[model samples]
Target: MEEKILLKYIDVPDIEKIEVYQKHDGYKGLAKALKQHKPDQIIELVKASGLRGRGGAGFPAGLKWSFVPKDSGKPVFLCCNADEGEPGTFKDRLLMEKNPHQLIEGIVITAYAVNCHQAYIYIRGEFSQAMKVLEQAIEEAYEHNCLGKNILKQGFHLELSLHSGAGSYIAGEETGLLESLEGKRAEPRLKPPFPASVGLFKGPTVINNVETLSNVPHIIMRGPEWFKGFGTEKSTGTKLFCLSGHINKPGVYELPMGVPLKELINNYGGGIIGGRKLKAVIPGGSSTPVLTAEQVEEVAMDFESLQAAGSMLGSAGVIVMDETTCMVDALANLTRFYAHESCGQCTPCREGVSWMAKIARRIEEGKGLEGDLELLLDICDNISFKTLCPMGDAAIGPVVSFITKFRSEFEDHIRQGRCPIEKDKSIKVRG
Candidate 1:
């Protein structure tokens, strides 16, 4: 069943305006936090809520915040990871476009909770409409005293700004984002002094996805117990899932965190298009490992369950593929993307991803040799966990998963000298 916690007012007309948002109790959570709870108390409440980061990595949000030292002698910063670069993921873009104020209120409350006075929303550059809407919403928040100096007259100050990226997918990584925000190359940095202790401008920083921060207001307003009532024991609260690919009704759905993959496809997504048999599902975004149809039957759409299923609930980008889809061709297309997007910071990811793409493309083009499949797997082994960041692992996931689960298809392409699946020309397979 769908639970509209973060998206409760998403479809409400004029919800983007500060006046309309306030009328619907928009900043009440900020008010409550300012009046009743101290900074640490807010963190404790969030920790109790079991809110995890929604930006791929399922780290606990409250625990992440607690890592910031109480008296660090340097200013604390909050960064909203709005770089929605994952293929088939657009939930963050939708939230920023339709209900900008909701996100703004969430950011302000988070800044207050972590003693952060300066913050940045490092958004994807192509989101022009979202940028315009957010600019206006920020001004309106300032006019209403929801941001800027002495917010809500509580003597808490914050300066929120927006920085546009050059559409680098690597910038979605926390360290990569900090480098981009600092006017440097958008490549990830080494961790040890993690962002909680040392980040932007050499200060403690808390970076969270737009959806993750957007949940703060609800948790503060409704309390942790109420928020926990929606999802499973470990994975609490509702999540915004971006359902795409071959489904009948593909869009962003707000459902309980642990909704079954079958339920989401049948109930909310209206099942597969043309009533065709399900072939495979990428359960998360394109970066997560592909799941065979059998694997998805009973899999729950949550962090633990997906990981246990040998995949991940990455960004909740549910990409569905029907039987007509060609597995060899699919793997080739995904590999090509990672090959192009690699920052080339690490030798293994740079050279190995390109090699994987070349092999997959050759396999799809019916020019594969008998040793090609083994070679592809070998490349993935070298790339996985051998880079500066997880981009290497991300690149290898689809390649390894496709070749493992659908090895026959790759073999058929090699043995028969062509793609075997007769794809439907009328139905388009979206990213």
Candidate 2:
């Protein structure tokens, strides 16, 4: 395997403990940040490293931090987005479960660099195990003086809290998370005032994904040159890819950013399950557009490469499918999820998602009429940029991609009034 940066010491004994973590160079970056570098220096180092958000958006981390007004006079808050509610994505869960202090240390270092004294980790409500683990880790940080008051007597006072969301998928969005953190209904806010300028109680806030912040200590320790040496020039460093679906070995794998998709499937994932032929894949998470088996033949798994291939490396959740899987059924299942997860904050998302789900379900059930395919595309077109948040666009991505890529399947459903691919009662659609 490629070099393991984030998951290097993940299997160490008692790595959750501060002393054990310290033995493995944990908090070394925080120590360096407190003593040697100023806040802007850290931001410059991040900018030089070319680190991007590991969240679905993949925004530049340093550019994002730079947007915070230094002289706004209002207190800046750094909120960690731990709401890993994306379908087929579970890499963040492993990070929090095995190495909670890693996240804590990353948070402290980021808060220091941003001149923020207070931070919050908005974790998903469903991850009860991860929440308990992080809470214990936070208490341990306080005990070790790594979180509260002056840390290592360097005059850096940071207060970190663990806030849990109400199991709403919309809360994973940055503005939606901020709104939910304030005890309001989980929904997205408008742009232009963006999170960097106006966020978390109308103060400057830097909201970063758990994986994004986790890269900070490593960057501070290894330097920008070292971090940029691995991945593509535009998309640097390694990424944690959450592999799921019909692959033989379905789990999370940390790899260099530009590794080819075929190698990840054939070598790391041990190829298709039951020796089945590959069918289709949702290159990233469910929200990203799907790719055919031929499309995944030789594409590199990076932000640029995937985008070049008409998809994205979003959240790096690779959902594979075999020849037996029906595209219509798969899209129907995905649309159902987005439909249910919609925050109902906008007309296109609120009403459009449900309409897409109903249409997909009708087609998957072999009741599709003649104009169903175009109608599905039309609904997606209306929902694309018409909603308050990206949820509307995200909801429509799969519908459009599946039909556009595999028009034959939807046509077969309409023509035959049943799934063309025969299946026994035991074999169900892989959602």
Candidate 3:
């Protein structure tokens, strides 16, 4: 219930303006870094703050920055992964739209900390309004000499570019985003030589999520101790949770890490719609496994706790479903999303996802055979960790999780030749 620290600038009038932002202690972080701290010291502070990537992977922010070889003469690039294509997630869009300068300030501070001279904000193509805000903010920053050529009178320089992807879910993946930025098809590259070692024109690069970078300015301005004061011990800092589905109040809520699921649903999300009984919850985005109401009450919304519950704090898209929602239909809907989004680069993902979607559709439609459940499990096992990227694993999470959590619903479809939850319609379908 605390006022949002990250979204503090959201309501500031003319927040995109550099002058307006600076008036509100916006560039103070870059100024502090420029005046007092060395690159390594800034990195140390970030490490101390315990900031993890909010873009899903939950990788340590400072650790990721440290991977860039400082001695490498190659130009280091800092890319803010603003291409938020994850289903049921839209927090990044709010940050970009309401407070573009906050993201810019954070990016500048992050680039300085990582000793990078150039940075890019790779926004999704569909976010036309967000793109406009960011572009205008960039131009304002340039005019104020905050973005290019000796920022804050320090010897350090930074150039920020706004690059939009052609709207692909795969583009949200780090390697795939890199490929898209290079003016090629957005397919993920192999990861022996990770992006920190060689990336973005084969130079040492650091890619961070938009939300992760947005936290930098605050960390630098308020000090690591102040920033670490909130959230759990391991997962520090507040997270922007996009609450949706059957909730009474379906909206974005910025809460600290380790917030109880019940509190988040009841207090922030206004409880379930129409006073319907809580059934299940996708703790993270669609990629995460659904948690039954009992599991939801026990699970805390954080990286470690969610992982321990056989799911992940992926993108913080909390989709709450009531008892009226059928698990079979939900799984089918999510499977279709992944199937449509697969880039067709790898056989397992391209084929396995499509196969799963087909079978799920059949099951949802009451045409499922007896062996279809076992076959679905088989497909999930093959696709879980055998592909080029996490996409395959993500594709299989819902299927495996749904069957495990709601086996009776799946069996009912196969046995009675109709979804048990929907007697009149034979199947449950809703948008």
lDDT of each: 0.92, 0.91, 0.90
Error in Å for residue 148 of model 1: 0.5
lDDT of 3 by residue, 4-52 (tens): 6788777788877778888888888888888999999889999999999
- Comparison by TM-score, 2 against 3, better one: 2
lDDT of 2 by residue, 93-137 (tens): 999999988899999988988899999999999989999989999
TM-score for predicted model 3 compared with the true structure:
0.97
TM-score of each: 0.98, 0.98, 0.97
By lDDT, the best candidate is 1
In model 1, the number of clashes is: 0
RMSD of each: 1.6, 1.9, 2.4
Residue-by-residue lDDT tens digits, candidate 1, 374-400? 999999999888998989999999998
- Looking at model 2, report the run of 10 residues with the lowest lDDT sum: 422-431
Model 2 / residue 263 / CA error / Å: 0.4
Least accurate 10 contiguous residues by lDDT in model 1: 422-431
